[model samples]
Target chain A: MYRQGWLGWLFVAPALLLTCVFFLWPLALVGWMSLHNWPLIGRIRWIGIANYRAMLNDPIFLQSVRFTLTYAAAITPTIFVVAMALALLANGDRRFVGLFRTLWFMPTAIGLSTASVLWVWMLNGQVGIFAAIGRALGLVETDIPYLDSGTNAMIAACSMVVWKTAGFNMVLLLVGLQSIPSELHEAARIDGAGAWQNFRHVTLPLMRRTLKLALFLSITGSLLAFDQFYIITRGGPQNGTISMVYWIYNNAFSSFRTGYAAALSLVLLAVVLLASLAQFMLFRDREDA
Target chain B: MSRNTAAWLYYAACLAVTGVFVFPVLWVLICSLRPAAESALPPAWIPSTLSLENYETLRRVGAGLWRYVGNSVAVSVGSALAVAAVAALAAFGFSRFRFAGRGVAFVLLLAAIMVPFQTVLTPLFIVLRAVGLHNTLLGLGIVYTTFHLPLAIFLMLTAMGAVPRTLDEAAMLDGAGALTVLLRVILPLVAPSLATVVLINFIAGWNEFLAALILMTDQSNYTLPVMLVTVTFGYMGTVDWGALQAATVLTMLPVLALTLCFQRYYVQGLVAGATKG
Candidate 1:
């Protein structure tokens, strides 16, 4: 055991050291900074709960919290449903399944920022492909500024996310799909279950783990969204699209409010922690039942 | 129902969905070839005057878009190497030994997954500044590696776990060094997973926006995502949508080709990380 201990430490040293130097240390340092009134280029004064309390009272920060949650609520389920649907469609044992999978999965590998850039052009009112196609096909009689309005831009951003991620999620869910034993489906079919019935009774049960993973990831990712909003809309049309993370970003890096940013981060971390714990408990309870 | 009708229905559905999935990316490619003036208002999907003008003009644009591409590659490759190396060593250690705090370490790394990066950016900023690593590739690389280490380690450890410890035991008895056994025997077995991690981490590091955005102030050092943001900046502050799209296509082309080609490894890598299979 003694020899094993040394060896383990030796092996784990690089990871532990790196994590300490990087992740845990930074996390702790940030926590410390949050407790003080930290300016970007001035003496820091300890002011417990002041930064947090200030943001807790700030209307813009409050709006950001609401907006962020609302965005996550909108995007998470939409991505999951679309991903599962794509998974079902792409999982057929056909020779062209790989082709379909790649085609679907390709968008995800494209950087979100890149996608945002491409989308701005694709959705531009005059020269844009969508507008052109819509005009040609008589789908619309007038040019619409797709990213010029908050509601419309938000929808387009969310749609871009769905398009980029559904295939990625499908690919994730595909792993879940593949790991399901085929005979379970065969057995269900023989027991007079139709396709949907088999899916509900057999597939969904086995896919629980993958579904949880996808949901958790999509939710967390959506909540932390920055690149899309930053690149696509700049949280624009009057800051209506400003997300919590983006707000925190504007505080820290843009406005140089180090203390305020740190406090917001800790609060965001707490929210994510609580949410993850709830998810874990919910899944555990389901498993127990 | 007739078999032909059913098959045709499936085909039609697949084609329609594919069209939606593929159209934007394809449109960008077509848009890139158009003359700059025509690019703004050309209604035709195919431009009347085709030119590689944007790709050629991309170099001359004050954004330093091509330099951003180079910076992206440098940071991405560096971070990927660092993450993979640290992750592999830690993963190997975890897989082989039952030791104190092992579970705690593993749990912390796993929990790090749920830690919203935005929350950590402030502290990371301070840390980088203190270490005098701010506004540098090395600083960006360190941040990316640490942020990405959890998943990469999880991927390697899972793959390493599948290689029975008996082989390690046997190799040890035969006088093989731990490093030798790891490099010679274990690494080869997990090549596919390593490749997957490489590709996944490469794409992630390449696209990572927040830290790169915050850390690097110099246009000469901008990553692709940062450069993508720069396309929005102008004298009148109006975003250049056409040039942005053209740049987007140029930046994405390599990653798109890589993922499309090595997609299978991606699936394997994801499953390895997700299920620890």
Candidate 2:
């Protein structure tokens, strides 16, 4: 590092100032707001932990917490598996590898909301292709209600997310795979190691950091999922699809219970931080082992 | 198996995977191209008719399709450029300097990554409204730029580190100031990294929904993603599938084009950001 003295601070001032004003300040404000009865437009009154206490009994909020966990639990592993398979398939330089990579990564380029909208059309009962295929396969008497039921809505939303994001994780994993020098594989081959063994011994160990990062992003993203559920399911089928963030949004905007929403937001943040911390520990523990 | 058979088998496996990823997009494109009446027919790999009626319908939405398109483009591009400039400076400082509390500041910046912005939406909305920027495109762009800083700074720092110190040192010896060296001597060498930063930010800002949905309340101020949501659920709680498909295609077009053009840098940013974390 150069000894640039105060010049260094000048260079970093804009970034630091923006972060402080936009991110850190809001973060502190959220903490403060959670302690008050802050409505969208009303007199603010300090209520201590009333919002937090109310959250424990708020049936919708509790259900949202559960549903969000269920959705994240279901989607995170699914994306990781599909992305890993794609990375393995498209990792190396072969014919049309670039074509395949681009194809897989294409959906991710589209916004999640746009992808969700497309899926909304794709899952429509009358004109949806999925329903048409279901009929052609004799799977249903007519257009299956893909979004009408809670289980099916979960499935459709999860599938749409996998389609949208798996390729991104695939690219991250592919980079990790490629960064493992080809010579290691050659050395493993010279030792008569089989493909599975080579991957297990050489690849998995070396790819741990990338795996952790990808999984961290996937889990946190799934935890905060809102647009897909909001646009496609609209927290419908009797509110079975309500996510944590969705509930927070409803409280903050729909009900104008800004303080309650702020409290819920803090809880979500705690859960996400804990989840990521757990992942970091789990990966590092494996490294030690 | 013979080598030829192995190659064909490999191709077959890849083709199958590609079908799963590509068919949805192709199907969407086909559906978007079909006449609004024909869209109700059963799924067809081939469209019997082609029309732009659905796209034309998109123009009937509030402030028209072009308005939202322009809004999204302006916000995303503006935010991307702003982020690149700010992040380039921060990366330069962090990578090239020794200063008091530098490590602490870096940690604070990275901490933003850990806290998902969704959690802070309420306070952020309040803050923006207090500052009279809640419903404005500039506020949205500022939010995007602020959130993008950590990753952009990280990527730039890595890129700047890869450039030899001797290059900048030579410029310094010629009596060039630090900012001058950064602008004239260092930035040109890291153009690819700069592109990566811009593309990443642009795609993210263009597609960002939750913040935009929360912050932008006016129909006229809606970004494309928010507008799409309104078009989907806002019309007496009914979805006009054709218009939605057409709109989706329009939204994806710029992102896909940029990704294809900048695939190398885009992929580099993804991998570098992940591995660095």
Candidate 3:
């Protein structure tokens, strides 16, 4: 019996040790550095809550806050709608379903930064395909600056994300849709229900769990968005497209204010955690009640 | 239109979407051959003249290209293998043992899924600095492994649960040790789920951007996402549209090839391993 304990520990030891040393310990260090003034090269001093206070008042940080929330707000709906539509279209019983799935899912597998850079080439104001098409179509006489200002930049960046992520979301939703017993839909149809009615009543209820999971992931992922903004906008024509995480990255990595970045990171963490937790709790309550 | 015609209309609407989605990529493929100057306006959808300059430019910058791809492959494959190994054992523990805090431990692991790495970014960086891991490939690999283990462990447990404890009993009856059962019995039965775990982790690790961006300092160490971003940002003054487009096309080929080749195996495994867990 005693020998079994030794074997168990032996089996699990390697992973435990690695995670402890690498994952847990580093996390603790992050908390410690946030309370002190630690730089990449030299100098370290503990200044309790001063960094935190600065984060609250920093105008740049606030701009990032507004931008991140707004971007998350914009992308979640856009992505989900696109994904659901794709799922429905792909889920049909057709000869070309697999081909369509592959085409749509193609963009999702490409890296977001790669897509952003690719889109940048495609959106170059002077010689981009988009500008040429726009001019030819008589939509505009001149190139409309898509990335010059925050609004158009957000539109541009969010579109890249939608293109990159929508197919993935569709696949997940497709799985959920398939899992819903067809009996539910067949019975609804027996009562002379139309396509829209079947979707509204039977389909929607069955998808609650999947929808919740997808929504939460989309919301949280969008909140932490960084790549497209970093690549496509570089915080934009005037840094208007910069999000919260980008701001943290610039401060910590670019400016070398590691301590201040750590403090700001903690703040961002608290906010995201609270928001996610609230969403999770609401779902749990709704499910039970 | 008749009711039957409406069904055709629905198909037409959705198929039109497929066309819209394919348009940009098709334009890209066509323009890739066009002369750089002639590729611009008058809105030539088809290139009158084709050239290979764009492809040549990518070959010249192969180091910068290959390094990012290498970082991506190494980090992804490494994390998937390591995370799967850890998760397999941990899953066995959770499935077989009736220990205190088992449920709580499971809950905590599930809870970890919702915790975005963003909250821990600064902390994770500081920790990397303390351990002399920052700016290193190995350091970033460690972060990827950490992020994957929770879901991996959960998936492993669900997969391992499909394994019958009777096999362990039978093996034990023959004086086989627990390690022997895991090696000879449990591990083999859970192969499907293991494939799932590996595929899922590999995909997740491949796509990981924020951690790689934050932790790695040097350009030599930059993953594809960082490299792409850096190239785009640096070249903003006088952007090389041809080279950039060629690079994007070149980068996408590998991912497309992998997905197409592994189409059946990947999604099936991912869905099975992920669904219950």
Candidate 4:
């Protein structure tokens, strides 16, 4: 193990080089761009802190942040609840559990944009299957306008996200569940613990790491969501659904305001980092307690 | 309730959940096969007239769906291979060598995992343009590989860690070079992790939207996801539901095939990458 040479560097060079060039360099450039007036097709002007200052008072940007957080807060619980239920149901060695897992996880493979397109057609006002089923079941007299209103659009987008992502969380949680030793459950039973008690004390505590990871991923994914909202609602119903990333996309690509978009991107990065750090610290403190 | 009753209830609940999760895709599949002009109003659970006309129309539609499929395949496969190659090498270095700045470098790489691709979009765009890779599939592949490298490297590090050091030592004692040991001994042992990285990268590259949309401005170079969005929305006035469904189905087919074929590895990769990372 004491033998050392330049071979290690040779092995790591390509990856480190790619990271420096593509990841770190671009990140540093984002920081630099945020301080300037970097338009798409003009001479870049070094206007220090102007983009950040403008964002402070920009109602649309503020709305985008509020909307993105609302969407993330709404969808995270929906996904986790369904995911937990799926994990519990599929935890055991039941026949066809493999099939069930496969079916559940099949949607995660579908791109969000493609899934949005499929759902858009499925939830269409006139010929959508949701409308047809609703009418057939006598749930409504006419087509259900699932994406027409602001609240309805949010609901539609959340449902699509939950469908697309819950499977992924389910798989992760299932791993957590399966990894829990059956001896622990047996010990709980020996202590006269009921099902609720067993789950509350044994299962929840044991799965904390998996739960935290899943929550972090789901929350961050929802915060950075773009494809579904962009495709399904187009931030419609008076632009009520414009997500943070979608707004950044509009500024950077559509409006050609690279500097402002870069500023927004940096703020978002900071928020995500802080949120993740907070979650990590909270979990660590809980473990310590 | 009795034990038998509880078991039955569990089975019923599982079936209900499965149906809820699988029904939308099934509905889309049926819709894709339905004739274009059909009202599809009464909810044709079973199509009266099954036709492949929509798929045919999809093939002949704007931008030619096959081109997007080819572009996606090239980009996804190219990126997955590139990431796997680079990550395997780096993971080997991190897992085995006690090199200088090893911990710092690894930490830096892991930090990139939390940095969303959006943060790097503006600068990356400028760099790609500067390098004259503005609308190239190769450029997009490189970006996908770079963005995916952190997770891939971390996962591969775990994979390589599970491999005992004795194997490397034994290989070196047998006069095998580091590359030979990595390629000959360690790699074959870590095939499962390599497969996991490749599958995950492929799915991610295939599904990546914002980057592809921003980088690949030309229609001819558009990946399937970007093309599907453009084509579906490009016809803003008259939406072709039939063709759109067909296109969506086409877009999902390869990933679905990959998932079904490698279901176990897919689950393992996902869980390890998420919970263990």
- The most accurate candidate by TM-score is 4
Give the alpha carbon lDDT tens digit for every residue of B1-277 in model 1. Answer: 8988988888788888899999887878877787877766745756788887776656766656567777888999998888888888888888877788888888877667767567888888888888899889998998888888888988887789899887887788888877788898899998877888788888889878788888897778888777766775543477655576678887789889888788788666655655541
Q: TM-score ranking from best to worst?
A: 4, 2, 1, 3
Q: TM-score winner between 2 and 3, please give it.
A: 2
Cα lDDT tens digits, model 2, A71-115, are 988998899999998999898889789899999988878899999
- The DockQ assigned to candidate 3 is 0.47
User: Which window of ten consecutive residues has the lowest lDDT sum in model 3 chain A?
Assistant: A1-10
Off by over 4 Å in 2: A1-4, A179-206, A286-289, B1-5, B234-237
Residue A132, model 2: Cα distance from true site in angstroms? 1.1
In model 2, what are the clashing residue pairs, if there are any? none
Report the lDDT tens digits of candidate 2 across residue range B1-277. 8999989988898999889888887778878898887766666778778999989988988889889999999999999999999999999988888889988999998888888899999999999998899999999999999999989998898889999999878998899888899999999999989999999899999999999999999888899998887887857566677888888888888888988888888777876766664
Distance (Å) between predicted and true CA of B105, model 1? 4.3
Chain A TM-score compared with the true chain A, each model in order: 0.91, 0.91, 0.94, 0.93
List each candidate's DockQ score. Answer: 0.65, 0.73, 0.47, 0.67
lDDT of 3 at A232: 75
Instruction: Using DockQ, rank the candidates from best to worst.
Output: 2, 4, 1, 3
Model 3 pairs in collision? A30-B123
Candidate 1 per-residue C-alpha lDDT over A220-258 given as tens digits, one digit per residue, 9 for 90 to 100 = 777788877876787887787888788888999888888
lDDT to native, each model: 0.80, 0.89, 0.76, 0.87
Residue by residue across A1-289, what tens digits does model 4's lDDT show? 6268456777888999899988888999999999999998989999999999999799889999999889888998889999998888888887899888889989988888889988888788677878877888899888887657878999998888889988989988987898899999999999999999999999999998788888988888888889888999998878889988988899999999999999999988987888888777877877742
User: What range of 10 consecutive residues in model 2 chain B has the weakest lDDT sum?
Assistant: B268-277
Q: Give the TM-score of candidate 3.
A: 0.90
Candidate 3 lDDT at B30 equals 69
Runs off by more than 4 Å, candidate 4: A2-4, A190-192, B39-42
Cα interface RMSD of each candidate: 2.2, 1.7, 3.3, 1.9
